[model samples]
Target chain A: MLLGAWGIALFLAGWEVVGQTGALGMSCPPLSAVLAVLADPARALLFQRALGATLGAVATGYGLGLVFGVVAAAAGHLLPGMRGGLDRTSSVIHAIPSVALAPLLILSLGRQATPAALAGINTYFILYVATSSGLAGTSPVLRDLMSVLGAGRWMRFVRIDLPAALPTLVSGMRMAAPGALIGAIIGEWFGASRGVGVIILNAMQNFQIPLLWSMVLLTVMISLTLFWLLGAMQLGAARRYR
Target chain B: MPTAVRVAGVSKRFRLDGGADFLALDRVSVSIGAGEFVALLGPSGCGKSTLLRLVAALEEPSEGQVTVAGSAPGELARAHRLGVAFQDHALLPWLDVTANIGLPFRVAGRAVDRARVSALIGLVGLAGFEAAKPRQLSGGMRQRVAIARALVLRPDVLLLDEPFGALDAVTRRQMNIELQRIWSEQGTTTLLVTHDVREALFLADRIVVLSPRPGRVARELVVPFARPRDAAVMRTEAFHRLADELTDALGGGA
Candidate 1:
């Protein structure tokens, strides 16, 4: 833990130094300047609205994606006939970049729901892969034992396969957190009314370097916090289930 | 005695990764009488475990049939009349000893019989460690929990594939002694697969030795030692002679 803190500290310090030196460009404003912009009272409501909008989209997308992913994986497991088709369909969906799909999603889902749709799509693919593989990875010996013990399909799933797949599922959840955030932000770039992504794009176009950097910093902090929380859950699940 | 488990002219074949058929057992037949303790003894790769798996309904025979209590192996399993343990111990890592032992009842959609579970825990000498998880226990302790689990449902037939094969010699012998005592009390028809000569001589009512690669029965011996046999029985002259003969047969078969 101490080593990880040191690594983060070193990285932040390096970023500050590069920004202070103007090594990259005018857009690479000093970290202190970005913090000042973030701390400014006049801009607080704007930042709050943007953060809330983005977080709401992320939550909706992530929850739906996780539920669908687990359900689809379970269905694939219980009915072997659908597994190949599920795999192929999810792969084809994931093959198309989210950015390319953003315009089509905007047209159908409208600008208001587009961020969540994009986020859900990204989360769905990641969780589907993780859950399906994890379900298949149950120990053969345990499966045999369950069979000999007269475990029915539902009993075996609840008692053995689900618990065994938990570690992998938690890890996938952690990964999907950042992906979901990215999807929401990217969706906002295609002209959402209010979001961190919208403000960042506006700042970039209008040459508001410190505001742009502040929004980026805020987005990263939110993503890291969610990732770190899920990482802890993943560790607990791994220790318990394995 | 009525038969508890019967394998009549059963053969098992596996399709290897290279798409070639690997014969595991060739027309192997064995009948275990009700309440009898039988051991299928053979060396590694002799397919004795395959035979046990057949009885456990974990695999289907390429030819012939396996029956337990006058029904198919799958039928017996579906009726929740089967119990099994393996070299890997096959205990759920997340469940404590009591929950693991109570798994069969839950699987059968029956209420958890706390008394029966506790009794079996005591029978396996894991009484005080009922709350311990599988990973927290030593290997022998884990195997003891597994044995307790196999006995918890009063299963009509117990299938054990090298339950003690991974333990040290001393622990294995100790487990054998405990298993004999446990079996004497329960008298559930059992078929244990192992390569250990002394293990077979010590615990089995009868030993059937099988030869390797497309396994066929090479020898069968009815143990002469009287029960409730103790460790001292293993030191007896009769035990030694039987052990030696079985060891020689296993070595020759390999």
Candidate 2:
């Protein structure tokens, strides 16, 4: 664990040194410069507003997608005939590039709603796949026990299937966070009202390297933090469920 | 005597890969009187467990019928009258000992009977470990919890499929004695499936030996022992004699 942390620290130091040396052009600013831009009091409100909007979109999409995915997976599990159709539909939706779907989402839901909608779609696909497989992964021995105990379909699902699926479902949530974040950011690029994606895009075109790097670094930190939290949940579920 | 469980000419065939069927059991018939302890003894893969599975309603017979309490095996299960423990124990890892024992009550859509739960916990000697989860318990303790769960509902019939088959020799013997005591108290029409000859002789009122696969009932011996048989009985000459005879039957002897 210490080695991993040390490795990351060294990589960061190397990145800063490389940028400071001007070896990779102005696009690669020193880490200190990006931090300075992020911590600047003059630009505090601008960054805060963009971050707030982005966070709101990500949260909204992630929550909705989780609920939808879990419900759909449960429906498929209970109703066997629905399994095939739901699987194909989810695959089709996932296969359509989010980039290509962005303009269509913007057209239908408008700029303000586009980011959340895209994020939700991305989150939904990952969670659906995870939940379906997790539900199917119930142990054959446990299934026999359930049958012998007079457990009905609904009882079995509630008492065994759902709990058994939790660890895998948490893993899916861990995976979906970055996808949701990326989907929101990409959606914002296609005319969203305001977000970090807009700030990053503006900084890129205007050649404000530090601000661009600051946004990217902030995004990475948030993504990693969320992943870490969900990873803990996955481990907890695994310890209990398995 | 009233028949609590009746297995009449039941045969089971499992389909393997490539459309071939493996005959697991031939025509086998057995009947257990109410409150009797019957053990199906055979070598591993001799379909003794398959016969128990039929009684538990976990499998359908390819031919013939298995009736528990004068109806289909599933009916007894549907009424929550059947209790079972397998080699795997099948305790939900997420639930602690108390909740795992109380699972049958929840499954039956009835309120959790705290009094009965505590009684059975103590019955199986798991009193202080109620809050402990399955993973925290040792093999013997986990199987004890499984037995407690099986008995919590005061089930009409108890079916045990090699419940202590995975335990160490010392633990297995200790478990057998405890199980004999437990069975004596409830006197529930019980069917135990085991490959251990000593386990069968120690706990069963009657031992039904099966031949090698495809399994058929080879011999039956009435255990000539009184209720609540002691561990000392295992060291008896009669016990040794019966054990050898059953062991011979298991070795494919006619």
Candidate 3:
């Protein structure tokens, strides 16, 4: 609660300073003006629609990435030779900037949520590497113990490997959450009819500084909420393990 | 006497990358009788552990056959006839004490018997810690949990690879007593690999001493102590005599 209050205070203070100083060619809008726009129910509906669209794309992409990442990591152990090739390909994908690839994804998927999905493509690789390394990191002592106890391969994986890999997987998911949202917004910026990205683009084209600032605040709120949700999930899983 | 296990001309060779094959165990032969507690005493790298693994079916002998209960060790393991514990408490950290102890039964697709689990927990003196995770327990307690887990299925034969090797001296002594008590109660044929001569003497019905490098049996000493042996047995002349005999058999270096 204290952190939330500090965040609101800092944002308002920054808004006031930028508005008063008129720096950065600023016709900076005050916090009250943004809140007033938010209070307008009809305008609020537009923001809500944009928020919904962005969230939908992010959610879909993140879900797909998470499922595929875990499966790939588990399969990597069953097929050792494939691990190096898959890891190299994932690193290459990670190296490509998501923003630069947004246009290509849009072209391929015909300007739908494909670009956002592309933004989340790297998320799985991060999670896969983390999970696989975590699984591989089972101590030799522990491995010998299990083997001596007559635990089969499946038993070892279920009993030892999965629990050990969970923390890494959760951290990877937390890291990927923001990336998913950013990918969605970048997709919208490149080619989309709706979303905060589209709103910010329009505001810039018309030189509507106050509206652009409002849209930026909305994006920050959305991203923060998504990140907090993922963090909560991580905490819950950790608690369960404890 | 029915032999519970027979390791005839058993040898194990491990090949390193771009290196010559390293012989872990030479052509070794030993037979353990039913319901006997035999300790494999050797120095580090003597392949005592390798021999134990062969008995447990965790590894196959490179040159010879290892049979447990008249069948291959692997078959005995699959039939839930072999149980093992290691020096490291291999309890699943995610599982609580009870769940870990129940694992063998669970693996065999048998329903967990709460009464049996409670009995085993009581046998290990871990009565109130059923819900505690392995990470939450101390090293000794975690090892007790591992021992309980190994015994949960009530296997005919038990294999231990220095199961108390990681504990402090005092705790190791206490655990030795606990192990003897448990073994007497269970009456399962048992094989233990340990570097500690006192521990082997304290717990084993017979001690098998192995020489260093390409491990082979050097001596076999039968322990004539009575059941329910306590830490006080360590202070007896007979105990010291046996320890000296085993120590000399270990070539005064181990």
The candidate scoring highest on TM-score is 2
| Residue A27 displacement in candidate 3 (angstroms) | 7.5
Give the TM-score comparing model 3 with the true structure, all chains together: 0.89
The true-versus-predicted C-alpha distance at residue B170 of model 2, in Å, is: 1.2
- TM-score per candidate, chains pooled: 0.97, 0.98, 0.89
**Candidate maximizing DockQ:** 2
- lDDT per residue for candidate 1 within A1-242, as digits (tens), equals 99999999998898899999999989788888999999999999999999999999999999999999889999998889999999999999999998899999998999989899888988998999999889999999999988988888888898999999999999999999999999999999998999999999999999999999999999989999999999999999999999
Worst 10 residues of 2 chain A by lDDT: A25-34
Query: Per-residue lDDT for A16-118 in model 3, tens only?
Result: 7776666745567677776666667878789888878887878788888888888888878657888888788778877888877777787777677764576
Return the clash pairs for model 2, or none: none
Clashing pairs for predicted structure model 3, backbone only: none
- DockQ agreement of candidate 3 with the native complex: 0.40
Model-by-model lDDT, in order? 0.92, 0.92, 0.82
lDDT of 1 at B145: 92
Clashes of each: 0, 0, 0
User: Whole-model lDDT, candidate 2?
Assistant: 0.92
Lowest lDDT block of 10, candidate 2 chain B: B245-254
Off by over 4 Å in 1: A1-11
Kindly report which residue stretches of model 2 are placed more than 4 angstroms away from their true locations once superposed: none
Candidate 2 on B114-135: residue-level lDDT in tens?
Answer: 9999999998988899999899
For candidate 1, lDDT tens digit of each residue in B103-176? 99988999999999999999999878989999999999999999999888888999899999999999998899
Measured with C-alpha atoms, the lDDT of residue B239 in candidate 2 is 88
